[model samples]
Target: MQDAIYAPHWNRNAHSVICVLRGRAQVQVVDDFGQTVFDDELQQEQILTVPQNFAVVKRASNEGFEWVDFKTNDRAQISPLAGRTSALRAIPADVLANAFQLRQEDVSELKVNMERQGNTLLRPSRSSSQWRAIA
Candidate 1:
């Protein structure tokens, strides 16, 4: 796979185990306290566990990456924190603006930028230099 991000998301109903089958990947998982619980690069044959309800994001390296995902449930649902399907869109704009400590117009712009991406699996872009910086 090309350099891509799975996006920050959580599976409320199931835990998951991911095994890296090829290339390399960077994985980060945040706990309920909003602290990063795990952040590391994974190599071929490496495995990582993602507990249910924790938010996680995975980025494949520029060389590309592949992995097998195993979930506790036969059907798992994901709630993305950022993307067109993000839960943030469901919140009232005023509330979101207040929570983000931004002007309503700024919040609207943020929403627009997020929606413009339109993809849950994000491709690397010049604007996403920060994510690309991860080694």
Candidate 2:
């Protein structure tokens, strides 16, 4: 799990309360302005609440991360901010370029790279370049 990441995502209609079962993870919650709402290292037994539509991401520690979460909606729906099942993949490269002020090639590179990577639980390499800065 050292290379594992929960990926950046947001619940459409549910709020989640998560409790770490073991290991440690750096949890980050961001606002619409791309500002950090909460950024903390969660250890065993620690808990956090992610509000509905609020983006969240988790990076595992060397020992890996384990957690359990409950959502307000029984059939929770999630929209990942990165990876194949993300809006980034659905967006046209030209639109991405215009929105982020990036070159078309750069946007294509970002999207293509992420499309090859699955959504939800991802195990990105240490050297992998993340395009989270753009969106």
Residues 1-135, model 1: lDDT tens digits: 678887788988999899999999889999878899999999899999999999998888988889998999998987888767788766888999888898988788767767676566766557665332121
C-alpha RMSD by candidate, in order = 4.4, 4.2
Runs of candidate 1 with Cα error greater than 4 angstroms are: 91-109, 113-118, 126-135
State in Å the error of residue 113, model 2: 3.7
* Candidate 1 C-alpha error for residue 51, in Å: 0.5
Go through the candidates in order and give each one's C-alpha lDDT.
Answer: 0.81, 0.83
Q: Which ten residues in a row have the lowest lDDT in candidate 2?
A: 126-135
Q: What lDDT score is found at residue 78 in candidate 2?
A: 86
